[model samples]
Target: PETVTAFQLQKQGSEGSSGERALGQQEGYRVDESGKVYLPFIGEVQAAGKTVMELRQEISMKLIAFFPDATVQVRFLNFRVTLIGEVARPNAYIIPNEQLNILEAIGMAGDFTPYARRNSVMVMRERNHQREFVRVNTQDTTLFKSPVFYLKPNDIVYVEPLKAKQYATQGDFLSRYSPIFFPLVTLATFVLGLSVR
Candidate 1:
C-alpha cells in the first residue's frame, strides 16, 4: 500500500523481466538430448533428474541474485503420473497440480476391482538420478506414512492381485467345485419348509 509512486507500482507484477523469452513446457517434458532446459534466469538448470520442489528452490535462489527485490514463481507447467497394471484404466494422467496422492490416483482409475490386490501396489520413482521402487498396501491403514503414498510427477502405480482371486475364479470352471454350488443354508431352509408342510 505504500508504493504510491509510479516507479514502485511497476514492480508489483513485474517478474524481473530481463528480456528473456517465456519457455514452453510440456506434460513432463522429455529430457532434451542435452538433458536440460534453458530457463530464463537460472540458465540450464539440471531439470531432468530433479523434483519439482528442488527445481523451484534452485531457480528461486538464482532469481534472487538477479531480481534482488522481486518475486518469482516456478512450476512444472505440465506434469503427470502413470497408473498401470490391473487398474481399471491404466494410463498416464496429467497431474494438473501437486495435490494428487496414491488414493487419488486409484480413484482416478475407477477405484480397485475385486481382482486387484490391494496389498501389492507398487510405485516407481526417481531419486538422485536413480530409480527406486516402493510398495503400498491399500488394505493397511498406515499407508499414509508409506513413502509411496504420494504420487509424484511421472510416478507409476501398479495394482497386483492376490492368489485367492485366481483360486476363487478356478472353482467356477467345475460344477461340483463351483463356489456357488454348495449352500448349506439352502438345505436347512428346505428341511424347515418340509417340516412346516
Candidate 2:
C-alpha cells in the first residue's frame, strides 16, 4: 500500500548470564513498488495486502526456521499526511510518530488561514481499496470523539474556504461586467461615429 512505505523489524534477544539487552538486530525495511520486503533468510515476503499483525506473524514463522526462539515485531515507519486548501502552509508532512490527530495535523500545516471554514474541514482516506471521505468541525468540542479525529497514514485533510473569500475576490462591478458589455459598447460607438459622419 502507498500508505505503508517503510517499516521496522526487531528480533527479541535471548537472555544471557547478564540478562537480555532488549532487542537484537533491529533492521529497517522499505516496501518496494511490488509491495515486498526482503529479509536476510526469508527472501521476499509480500507485505502489501497483509495487515501489521499478519506480516509480523509471517516474519516470525519464517525467522523461527533459522532461530528456534524467534520473536518478531513489525511497525510502520515514515508516517505521512497531506493537507490542502485555506491553510498557512499546504503540503504533505512526514510525521515522526504513528499517532496523529486532526488538530496536530492542522498545526503541522501552519494552521488555517483567516478565510478557512473551520466547521467544514474534510478528510479523505483510502482503506481496503475503498475511498472514504469525512467532515470535521474544528470549532466544536465534540470533535474530540469523532472517528476522523485521529488521522491515518496518507490521509488528506482539506480545509474549505469561506464564502467571504469568494465575495472579496469577485472584484468591483465594472471589472466583472466589462467582459460582457465591452463588445456592445464598442459596436455602438462605431455605429454612432458613422451616423455622425
Candidate 3:
C-alpha cells in the first residue's frame, strides 16, 4: 500500500496558474492480492515485489508523456509496528515514514516499564508466510549488529515482565479489598478514639 502524489509545476508568467495543482488529491494506492497497483493514466503496475523508490521511478517515467514537468512522490502508508507486553503503552502504531529502528519503536510506546525485563526483548516477524521470532538483549551492545534491530512493517515487539512483578501481584492480597478495608479501618479508629475520650 502506498500514497502517490503528483504535482504539476506552473510557469511564472502563466495567468490563472495557482503555482502547482495536485493531480488527484492525496490518494492512497493499495496493491491488490496479485501485487499490482492501478493508476489513472498508467493502468496497473507491479508493486508487491518492488520498493517505494523503485515504484516512484517507474511511475515518474510513465507520467513523463502526460505531464513533462510533473514531480511524483511515493510513500508506504501502511508501514506499522505493534508494541505489547511490558511497555508503558501497548498498541499498533502507523509510522509516517518507512524507516524505523527497534529503539524508536519502543520509544514511541513510551519505552519499557520499570518491571520490564530489558534483557529479554522479542521481535516477531513474518517471512514467506512463516513466523520468525528473535530474542535480543537491550543491555547487550552486540544488539546493534543484529539484523532484527531495525523494525519492519507489521513487526511485533514484546517485552516480558520480570518475575518480581508477578510475585508482587500474587503476594499482595490487601490490594484486592482496599476499597472496603480502608473504610472499615477508618471507622474502627474513630469509634475507639471516641470511647477512650
Each model's TM-score, in the order given? 0.57, 0.63, 0.73
lDDT of each: 0.67, 0.79, 0.79
Error of 1 at 12 (Å): 28
Instruction: Please provide the root mean square deviation of candidate 3 (C-alpha atoms, Å).
Output: 10.4
lDDT of 1 by residue, 1-197 (tens): 33323113111211115321122322322346565766544567677667668877776788787667655444554356777777787766665465678998888877887788888899999776799998878888989998777777678788887787778767656656545555766787899999999
Collision pairs in model 2? none
For candidate 2, report its TM-score: 0.63
Q: Which 10-residue span in candidate 2 carries the lowest summed lDDT?
A: 15-24
Which model, 1 or 2, shows the larger TM-score? Answer: 2
Clashes of each: 0, 0, 0
Tens digits of per-residue lDDT, candidate 3, 1-197, equal 12233332222221114332111223366778798988767789988878879989999999888879878788755576888999997877766665888988888888999999999999999988899999999999988998899888789999999999998887586788888899999999999999999
Model 3 gets an lDDT of 0.79
Q: Candidate 2 — which residues are off by over 4 angstroms?
A: 1-27, 33-36, 44-73, 172-197
Report the candidate with higher TM-score, 2 versus 3.
3
lDDT of 2: 0.79
